[model samples]
Target chain A: MTTVLIVDDQPLQRYGFRMLLDSVPGTEVVGEAAHGAEAVRMAAQMRPDVVLMDVRMPGMDGIEATRRIVAAGDRSRVLVLTTFDIDEYVYAALRAGASGFLLKDARPEELLAGIRAVAAGDAVIAPTLTRRLLQEFARLVPPAADGSAQDSRLASLTEREREILVAIGKGWSNSEIAGHFVLAESTVKTHVGRVLSKIEARDRIQAVIFAYDHGLARPHAG
Target chain B: MTTVLIVDDQPLQRYGFRMLLDSVPGTEVVGEAAHGAEAVRMAAQMRPDVVLMDVRMPGMDGIEATRRIVAAGDRSRVLVLTTFDIDEYVYAALRAGASGFLLKDARPEELLAGIRAVAAGDAVIAPTLTRRLLQEFARLVPPAADGSAQDSRLASLTEREREILVAIGKGWSNSEIAGHFVLAESTVKTHVGRVLSKIEARDRIQAVIFAYDHGLARPHAG
Candidate 1:
């Protein structure tokens, strides 16, 4: 069962969340806190799978609490809840290491789905906020500079492996890469494995991020 | 009714889309384009509400077509489709100003929903891509740089409205801000509206972005 710690200053809000979570299968309310400090302390002690955080709490606010919980490096993932669709703290919370955030009024299923996603080590964001986030993200991330000559992380890749890395960055599956490069899917997988090991990426997602960071995955101007 | 233009090189693929869209209510297939150049020309001529674009077409690709269409400043919103979840071109398409994108294998209902969202002037991204996008976004966007001293935008905001801008950046609702500052919620809304106008932000989301852009919204280290 996935365990959760609910953090909110409003008792009624906490009670409402507790009721909903309790009604669901495979999810249990492990603890509840009325403020950030209590939430942080409980999270450390309880070590729940998900921390349902309220952003505008008393004492330490949710953003700072999320940072501390993540920095403490326990298994808990903070899923912030905000009253507004365009809350400013949500961005700070994300940068502060929050796994995700959702609208406080999100459908119960959406909240449950978010909790499940976060507990499984995936991140989630409210749909309403995502478009603006993407736009801001594209605007803020400068186009990658040519890094093949300078970044050593890319130095270990073979020319073929490097090509595979680029394909991975492009979100190509092994079969797609194989089709594009005229290789067997098995061979494509082997190349992907090798590339991941050489680049020290735990998974394809990190490798994609690495490719972008190193200029291997350039965003072409349309 | 939402009018759509389907652009794909594969005749069968176009036929499949045409059938599905035809079967759905509240949507009509207005035209079809076999290639990027055709897609652009058709988009300019027909002005459909949505363009269901495939990214890998020969000649002018979907990204280029999307860019040209967006540059033309028509009402059409391009929703790019890709075979893979993490298509590299998807990012470029977003940068190119497509309203959103989806996996080609997405459920028919999901595709219809995406079209509706795009036509309504909202942006959509495949849910699976959002986590990595947000992570990359957070990493790419630098923390606010304390711009109160230099930015002409900040000069226009009164001290109270400036506080409201920062609060908005934190994603506080009018009620939340009112509670925090002991003001009426309507008064908070008025201040927020003023802040948006003073800084020339179209809405709260843009205001949040502006706050981040100008360093009024700082991401604290966790």
Candidate 2:
């Protein structure tokens, strides 16, 4: 069952979430908190699978709470709650390590689905929305000042390894990459590990980020 | 009825799209082009509501075509088609000013839905995929070398204006920002306009990008 901690300042909102989530199969409301501070503490104590985070909180606000919870290093992923899909809260939450978000007005099924998706270690925002959000952010991104230095680091990667990094940045699964490139899955994994080490990335996600930050991968320009 | 220009090198692919789109009510297949060059010319000449562009054309390719189409200042929105959802081609397409994209294997209904969404000026990628793709790209981005100078532009703005810039960078819509700041929507609109001019951003999207590019906005760290 997916365990959730509902974090909302509004008691009614919290109660509504609890009532709805408690009824869903394969899901459980582990706890609820009225503000970001309480949510952070409860998240650590409860270690729930997902935190239904409300962005505009009373004491600390959901962004900081999300940052702290993520920094604390637990398996709990944050699914931020926002008043509007296009709110600044959602973007702040994402940067704060939120796995996903949903509008407060989302139907019960969508809320449950978002929770489950975050719990499954998959991001929740649709790619279209994600692109608009990211593209907007990316536009202000000037080429990394230290890009030349980063580019040199990539110079060590073999062509195949570079190709794998591009694939990873494209959000391809290892199996998908392996199939597309006609490489053994084990071989792809080995390449991935080597690519990570060579680039000094924490993992595949970091590696993908590294590719984009360094201009090795770029969103297609229209 | 929404008019469309189908651009794909493959005869069968173009024919398949034509048949499907022609059968759909309120969607007219205005014209067809077998290559990027033709597609660009047709987009300018016909000015269709949407351009169903295939990415891997032999002559010019969809990315360049999309860039040209958008650069020409026409009203047609480019909806790129690709073999893989995660292909760098899609990212490049977005950067090139394509409204959105679809995988070649998308269901007929999904394709229709996507076209309609694009025609309505909405992005069409799934939000989850978008986050992953954008997040990966965002991570690799380096601090802009000229950021200190660009930041000085933000320095001229009042504290409230700066806050609005952050909100814009986070992809908050105008009404959402107004609601968050508890300010009148008209006041928020004024602030947004000032923020845009002060930052030298062409539009809200550019302002959002500029915020991140200049470190005014950043994803939370874990």
Candidate 3:
């Protein structure tokens, strides 16, 4: 069963969640908190598999609570719920390490699905929403400090490795990159390994991140 | 009725799409193209509501075709269809001005829904997928050039103005910012105005982008 901690400032809201959760198989509510501070404390003790977080609270909002819970190094994944579809709370929650979020008015099935998706280490939000948010933020990012200068970290990579990094940053899997670039999967893997090491990235995810940070890859650019 | 142009290298695939689309009540396949070049030409001439673009093709690829079509300033919106889910093609397609994308293996209902969404100027990908893609890219973003040094563009802003900018970058709506900062909405608007003017941003979106570029706001941070 997936143990969940429901965090909300309203008793009615908490009750509604509990009632709905009780009906679902393979899921249980371990506890509930009215605000961020208590939520953080309860999370530490319960070690729930998922936390249903409310963004707005009387004191210590959901964002702070999420940051603390994730920072505490527990295995509890956060699934933030907000009244608004697109807002700072949702964005901040994601940045705070939330697995994803759902609208408060989401259908019961969607809510349950979101919870399960978060518990399974999958993001709760759809990929399109993530893209728009990133595009909006990416537009504000200042040009690299070095201006037109190539990132020094990239100097070590061969042309093929550099290409792999760009593809990875664009969220391409190894097989996709290989197929698109006409390289064997083994060759792609070798290139990916070399690219990861040269860029000092921990894994494919980090490599993608590095490519964006260094301006080697961008979303929605011509 | 929503008019669509099918662009695929394979005749059988185009035929399948045509058969399905012709049977749909609200959608009509206006034209078909065996390659990106033909698709662009047909898009310009047919002025269809949507273009069902296949990413991989001989000669100029879908990304290039999308960029050119969008750059042409036509009313036709491109909706890229790919066999792969997470890949560079989707990213490039979005950048190239495709409204969004759908995987080829998507259910018929899902494909129809995606087409409708794209035609309506809505994104086809899920927001969660977009978020994950962005987060992955954000991780790779290089640290700010001057970690502690004040950005030159931010010199003119009042302390409150800077705070508002950061909030905007975090995707906070004005009311949310006002509530969190204990400021009136009118005052927040004024501050936003000053921030935008001082930074020479065209709008809120640009300001958010600027904040990320200047290292004022981050994707994942404690």
For each prediction in turn, the share of the native Cα contacts (below 8 Å between chains A and B) that it retains comes to 0.20, 0.11, 0.02
**Residue A186's lDDT in candidate 1:** 97
lDDT of each: 0.81, 0.76, 0.76
> How high is the lDDT of residue A33 in model 1?
97
DockQ of every candidate structure:
0.10, 0.08, 0.06
lDDT of 3 by residue, B1-222 (tens): 999999999999999999888888999999999998898898899899999999889988888888778778887888888887655565566656677777788778767877887787666554335445546543433234222235677778888888899888666778888999999999889999999999998667567667666766554410
Measured by lDDT, the strongest candidate is 1
Which stretch of 10 consecutive residues in model 1 chain A shows the poorest summed lDDT?
A141-150
- In candidate 1, stretches whose alpha carbon ends up further than 4 angstroms from where it belongs are A143-222, B145-222
What tens digits encode model 1's per-residue C-alpha lDDT throughout B1-222?
999999999999999999999998999999999999999999999999999999988898888888889889888999999998754676677777788888898889879988988888877777677667777765654455211124576777788998998887676767889999999999998998898888887667556656655666543311
Best candidate (score: TM-score): 1
Count residue pairs with overlapping backbones in model 3: 31
Q: Candidate 2: misplaced stretches above 4 Å? A: A19-27, A85-88, A106-113, A126-135, A141-222, B19-26, B85-87, B107-109, B137-222
Where's the lowest-lDDT run of ten residues in candidate 2 chain B? B141-150
- Kindly list the interface RMSD, in angstroms, of each predicted candidate in the order they appear: 14.7, 14.4, 13.8
Task: Give me candidate 2's interface root-mean-square deviation.
Answer: 14.4
Task: Give model 1's docking category.
Answer: incorrect
Q: Per-residue alpha-carbon lDDT of model 1 for A97-212, expressed as tens digits?
A: 88888998899988998999889887877767766776775555434421112456687889999999989867677788999999999999999999989989866755765665
TM-score of chain A of 2: 0.61
